[model samples]
Target: MLDTYFNFLQNIERTLGGGRGVKYGLPSTLQKVIALFRVDAAEIRLNQPILAELRLPSQFGDFNRITSETPYTEAVITGAEGHLGTLVLYGSRQWSDNELRVVHLIAQQLGVALENATYFAQMKLKTSELKWIDKFGDSLLNMLSSLQIQEVAGRIMSATKDLLEVEEASIMLKDYESGDLMLWSHTPPEKDLSIRLKPGQGIAGWVVEYGKTAIVNDVKKDPRWEPAIDEKGGFDTRSIIAVPIILDDEIIGVIEGINKVNDIFDESDAQLLRTIAKWSAIGVGNANTYEALKHTTEQLADAKKQTAMAHMVLNLAHKINNSVGAVRVWAMEMADELKATPHPSMEMRLMVENVLHNAEETLLMVRRIRGATELRPGDIRPIEVIEAMETALQFSRVDAAVKVERHYEDGIPRVGADAERLVEVFLHLMNNATDVMNGRGTLTLTCRRAQNGTVEIMIQDDGQGIPDHLRSKIFDPFVTSKSDGLGLGLWMVKLYVELIGGKISVTSTVGKGTIFRITLPPWEK
Candidate 1:
């Protein structure tokens, strides 16, 4: 036994002197210990990363391993950083005092070696992370050099994702117009699960709202995490690190690395993310500004085209109205002539009346077209509000699976708005809500007095909420989330609302729900 101890010490010295780093040191030390003790099997299970020795014939085969609930003798591997791992051994007989002392000494040696290994591994990781950081810095510079704002935005997303080599990454930009977080970009590029977070809604939302760095090794343990995002993204979020993109003392957005490929997120990862965010803030800010301007330019072009089309249609409508007016006068005269003949055939009289009715309907439709092209604001009291909403619901004809909720406060302020346009706005908004809910979920409508004495109205639905990319553009024409939509519903809704001396805005969360708020200028009777 004393000779075996000498051999083990000599082998350990050779392993330490080999200078092959800690990878071979651990298993080699275990092999030497096994040979000295003559154990049937041996294993070393790490604590931090949960790594364990492979089941080679010489190392281990079949044995339960744990700090507790295992049959084998357990040797605690203690290091400077608390317990490093556990060394389980299977020996045929109980150890003598000398043997036990030898085991303890081996474990102590292993602990020191493991502590050194852990530190070395960390340094290596830092070196690798620094390389990634350097790459990201170069990518940011390239992105900044690009004149295309959209391309720059996309590169920022890919660079951040590659910086940490995480399974998934996302960038959520805040809409200062609505105070909502919009998913700016996501990777893997194929999984374009457009996500949106209401202010202070989820982990990313929390980071953006508070302008803080969040490094969560386990999302399940964090209160700020919203698991619904995982369902939307189609992944299990084990860990996350989120950092805010601040510009000019304002949190413009949040950048996140989710589910590290092989490890949990740590300060080094956070530091890299923070560094990227700090350097890319100007780029992100400029990109967003350019996007907003581009979107507005497109909207103006669309609006101009629509205006020209409406002008031409209005002219045609006027011609149709004049022709129909002449027809109605002729029909009236014919009806009068038919009435004068007491013995006229009933069929002939009926024909004359039908012509008059058709002419009158045509004229009414032409007038309606004119009315729709113009904003005609009028008194909109609670009665008109209820009627318009009910009429809209009737028009939309939501599925039976959709539940409706209506709340009207006692002092619901009366506002001035075009009554007909109001119904159209509600109709379009409700139709959108129905589509998002997939014919199921609850639709809530509320009308009350706001703090500023204005009438506040809300149309809410528990549904698959709007995507972040399209959320800010909900009121912009040709920006629809639906696979089969003209994308003009919310655009019309906004147009009508604003034209009627009111304001409309929306807030949404992916898979949770959405709410559209409307405020109208109060009008006293």
Candidate 2:
């Protein structure tokens, strides 16, 4: 044994300066030592396979041939702190004290060499993991910048599969309305599968329900394994790791990797998945917040536009009223002078009367526009629906060819409203109905008591109804289907109805007709 040690040291000295640098070449060194000791056979085993096996020359033949029946001496290679592996030497004779001591020395040297190699390998793995994490984080940031939620989710699933070397990965999000776990994205997409899990129903659901990570090395052995999914999709799940995606201390979803490639899932894989889930949560939250902010900004812009439009309407109404009032006074004076003249021609009399009537009508229109645009606070009182309808029809400029029908229910309750404003609302609606009918169709006005303690008045027109695309936004400011309309009539009607604690809705069918329903609170007294 002593001579063998000397020869081993000489071999190391010769190989050290060969510039290959401490290539302990442990297997070769062990083989040389075994041959020098003349052991029948020898073998080295590590807790994990760190290097190739070493063997002595065989006249007695292979290690397997020696078998368990053969006598052997074994020494555990203990590192500075832990057992690295075991070293066993087999022979037909019992190992003597000297040979045992030599084996112990060799074991110690092997332990140190194996420990260093293990550390180097682990360091390399950690460096690679760090680089992967950095690249993944950068990619997520870019995805979130685009604010495409589904695209981000798909990329996350792909990155998870690559990072963990998994055969399949999926992202499951909680459906806000259904309260079910929905498969939002998956790698190697399954077009025919529609998977949904309730809370506490499956592995992914369990993670989300309990807000913890799950690592199942063998799905067949786990009670939480749900086989229905596998059976439905013809998929076999051998192992799985699921982690909750938490945001604001709440679990929003779960990310799962299935059947880790060529191996069972372990704590290290679970930890990696948890790290990825954290980044995914952040990306999802940011994207949702960005979408919300964008919607709010659009709403604010619309409100500003409506405010500016209202001011313009008020200014125009005032300017036109001033001009029209002067013309109304001049026409009235001219009509009076023509009537007072004796023997005046009938043509002059008829023309003067027409001018006076037109001037009065123009002044009335200016007043209605002013009332609708100004939105001024007015007297509120019990208003009889029939009386208000009569006033509106009296002021309306309906075409002579159009037919008008009125149906008033007896004993209907009066509505609580500003009589003057309500009159203006009805007048605008009647005018709109007339314009749509194009001087030929029927305009029907009906009044009744609604079940909800309100007065319901419906104005139905058998004119070409509003188009489908324009119906939804018909009441919004500056939206109109008319070439000569200001688009403010319906908007003002909506604003006035809402201000008076009423609701208005319209049902229209293109090329058929339209019905506008207005409901107002019934007068208590």
Cα lDDT, all candidates: 0.70, 0.73
Model 1, runs deviating above 4 Å: 1-137, 146-150, 161-168, 173-184, 192-210, 215-241, 258-271, 375-384, 390-412, 418-525
Clashing pairs in 2: none
lDDT of 1 by residue, 173-216 (tens): 88765788998777777776778789999988889777889999
lDDT of 2 at 173: 89
Per-residue lDDT of candidate 2, residues 1-525 (tens digit): 344454454463243221122244554666666676676777776675555322212122266668668887788875433576788877766666656665666665555445444433444455566875555554433333333467667778877888888998988989875779998888678556789999898899899999989999899999999999899777888999999998768788999999989888888788779877876775576446434433543444465557677778778777877887887788788878877888888988788788778877777766766655444544567888889998998999776787888899899887777788898899989988998888688989999876666889999999999998889899876689988776877988987787778899999998889999999888776
Please report, as a residue range, the 10-residue window in candidate 1 with the lowest summed lDDT.
50-59
Compute the lDDT of residue 478 as modeled in candidate 2: 67
How does model 2 fare in lDDT? Answer: 0.73
TM-score on alpha carbons, each prediction? 0.51, 0.41
Model 2 poorest 10 in a row by lDDT: 52-61
